[model samples]
Target chain A: MMRVLVVLAVVFATLPGVIVVLASLTAGQSLAFPPQGLSLRWYEVIFADPDFRDALLTSLTLATITSLLAVSLSALAAISIVRYRSRATALIEAMLLSPLAVPHIVIGIGILQLYGYFGLRADLLTLTLGHLIITIPFALRMLITSLAGMDRQIEHAAASLGATPRAILFQVILPQMKMGLLGAAISVFILSFDDVALTVFLVQPGYTTVPIMLFGMAENQVLPSIHAASVILLLASWLGVILIDRLIGFDRFLFRDGPSG
Target chain B: MQVAPAIRSSRLSRRATSLLLLAPTTLLYLTVYLGGLVMVLVMSIDVPPGVDSGGATLAHYRDVFGSAPIGAIVLRTLRDSLATVAGCLLLGVPVARYITASASRWKGIVLMAVLSPLMVSAIGRIFGWIALFGPGSVIADGLTALFGGKPTGLLYTEAAIIIGLTNLLLPFMVLSVASSRAHFEEDMSKAALSLGATPLSVLLQVELPLIFPGILSGALIVFSLSTTNFVTAALLGGSGRDLVGYEIYLDILVYFQQGRGAALAMLLLVVVVALMALAIQTGVQRHEVRDTAARTRGT
Candidate 1:
């Protein structure tokens, strides 16, 4: 019963993805299933279009920067929370994680309200900050879990052996956290990359991210390129999952290594 | 006396270092996150400029809650979210059991595959469902062929939204349940079986109660996420139906009625917060009960 159910679960989980891949090969204009013919025309069309090209670039750059900044910031915060053992740590963690429970649409509106209040125009920077608010919690949680489990005795030994503080940080601490750091960074990158509810509002008329652009296209017109673009994104994301799995050995039972569903 | 001074100095330095480590991220939380949320709450009551001719007013809230069409939209959104939660629970429990019971190296890979939906763009996944739910799709055609009737397209329906959201959340449900299941001792279940209890009875009476917290947590997560998710409904459920998130989005962006948008956003915030608080309180209570139970059992 368990094996059959597991197989069913796998089939159900991968069904939509498999359909998307198959549909991407349609030779026809519409996304008709059981493709009349097979071709890569959509992929070519997407490559030819500058909007998708620019949006992809914007998404990659934003995700890269956001992941780097949010992960490191959260790591520092996690260190303090785990190491300091203060009353304020509870309040700080709750505050940091509050954004997670808030609806993305609400967060988007809130950020928009913030922009209006400050008279600041929405741009990649503002959008980055918004994404940071959401992604930092995930990174911080992962780091905290790793930090809590770490062997501080090793660090103490290194210190007693006359190792410099910076050396202990680099050689002792960071190495132990390599998996958590990598997993958190991957999760952050993916979350930021695929973000939409907030990005839809923060994205300006001229500049856009892939998800925002995709949303716009899906709303208004049929871009044959959507198939190609979606396929590419789906593959890229799977690659990220694989990379994370290899790096962190995937906390399988909990599946906490990835972003929350 | 010599050691006392050194200990005091080291304590002071450690405190300073902790503060230093915490300062930057704390600053970010204060300015960006909390400040932004406060602004939204304020805007919810006080009208945004140029949206409508008004100062602080309850008119926006009235429009959201009092109006007939908007009420239906809210009801539909709630229905969709609840349905998604139920669907995920159905799939997640068995999958979670399978994962925790087996000593397979492939468990991690399977778990990742289940969560693979998160990696893809939300918009893209909705787009993917377009092919499956459309009239010309294989499943629709098969239905038509079997029924000797018109093809039943699944797109532009509430069901599509449910399906998409369930797909989006099934991983979370599985992860939650599986993690909780890991804490179950093999011997406990074995003992139950040895006591002449049927496997089914053992599962229902013994295992289900233990993992109920994980199930509830997963359900809360799905409920909160799906309620505010406009993507699936907007893309797959079509424009005929209006979800709260989509309505808020339109009110702000398309109509430029920021006041109304902010009001709806606040209402959504209230629902989300209430659910979150319930989850947190449940968590605290669960921990306390578990600790007490363990202590009594040990004694």
Candidate 2:
């Protein structure tokens, strides 16, 4: 039973990837599984198309900026919440994490409405802000875990040894937070990169991310080009996971100590 | 101990610094997230100016509940979400358990595969499904020929939506369950098996109770994701079955009913939060029971 389940699971997990790769390799104009012939024509088409190239670049840029902003903000917030013990701190923590509970679609609509009112409709900044709101929770959760696990005695000892406040933060605290920072940054990048629902509403003409462009293509018609894009995305994401594991232990990031700990 | 006073002053400074650091995040949450939620809630209550002269009526809520089309969409959304969550849990739990029980190398590979989807965009991943299940696809044609039936396209169907959402969300369940399964000690299971319990019995009686929290969390996450999902439903659900998320998009982007769109968005948010809270409450209750049991044993 276990073996059957494992095989089924592996097949289920790999089916989409396999289909995408096969479809991308189809020699025909339309997508076909068990491709009639094999070719890298779809990949070539994706590369040759200037729109796809631009969208890919935009996605990469947006992900980078959103991840950076989210990581810094969430790290600061997590550190503050942990350091200060107060009644309001719990409320604040809940508020920060509330984005996780709220559906991204509603947030997307809300952001559109809010930004529309402010005359900032359909801009990269709007998408960045929307992505930041969703990505903040992941970074905050990671940083909170890291801060909670950290032994404060070292910081106290540093202070006792005549280290300045900035010195204690930079030299003592920041070094220990390196793993957490990397994990948070990578996770934030992933979240921002994967964001489509939020980006859908905020995206304007000529500023499409890769996902939004893919969505548009799907809506128009499912072509082999979409499959090629999916294959690229899946490979990129898998590469990201491997890169993160190499940089910082993925297990450590996954199984962080809870807030109470 | 003259330095004691200086230490006290430094502590005060540290607090001030922490507060300063927290200000930006706090402000963003208030203005962007919480404020937007509040704005939507308020707008949900307000009657559309051209539709109704009555200010701040519950008419929008009434319309959402009374309209047959909207009500059916909501029901379909809930049903689809529940089915997706159930499917994910059924497939995810066993895989997670097996990975946890297996060698460390296999565990790492399984974990990576499970989490790989999280990195891919929902749009891209759904398009992957489209390629596989869309009209005239090989899978559909193969199944049709095997059954001696016509090749009916699976795209733009409820089944396709469920399948796509389940694939997208299964990793969430696997990761969550894997985390909880890591805490499960093998000794208890072995003891149960030695005491005349079958493997299935051991699983049901011992493992299930311990990992129930993980299951609940995973289900809640999947359900919430499915409920709020627009890309999958829009691409796969076709015109026959409209989800609330897609309807909201249509109202705002297609029909230009911004007020009604906001109203639907608010309703979706409320449902998601309510479900999440229920999940959290169950987890807390389970934790409390475990703690109480441990205390009783200590006594």
Give the TM-scores of the predictions, in the order they appear.
0.93, 0.93
Question: lDDT by residue for model 2 over B1-299, one digit each (tens)?
Answer: 99999999987877788778888888887787776677677777877776747658777777777789888898899899999998897789888887677765666666666666666555656666777786578778877778866676677789999998898888888877776666566767898899989998899998898778878888887888888888889888877687888898888788887777888888788878998898777667666655654574469
Model 1 per-residue lDDT tens digits across residues A146-201: 89988899989999999987798779988888888888888899898988888887
Worst 10 residues of 1 chain B by lDDT: B285-294
The per-residue C-alpha lDDT of model 1 at residue B16 equals 83
Say which docking band candidate 2 falls in: medium
lDDT of 2 by residue, A127-237 (tens): 787788899998998888888889999999998999997898789988898888888888788778767777888888788888888777876755687788877777767
Give, for candidate 2 chain A, the lowest lDDT window spanning 10 residues. A252-261
| Runs off by more than 4 Å, candidate 2 | A257-261, B1-12, B51-54, B146-150, B289-299
| DockQ-based class of model 1 | medium
Question: lDDT for every model?
Answer: 0.80, 0.79
Question: What are the DockQ scores of the candidates, in order?
Answer: 0.57, 0.53
> Which one is best on DockQ?
1
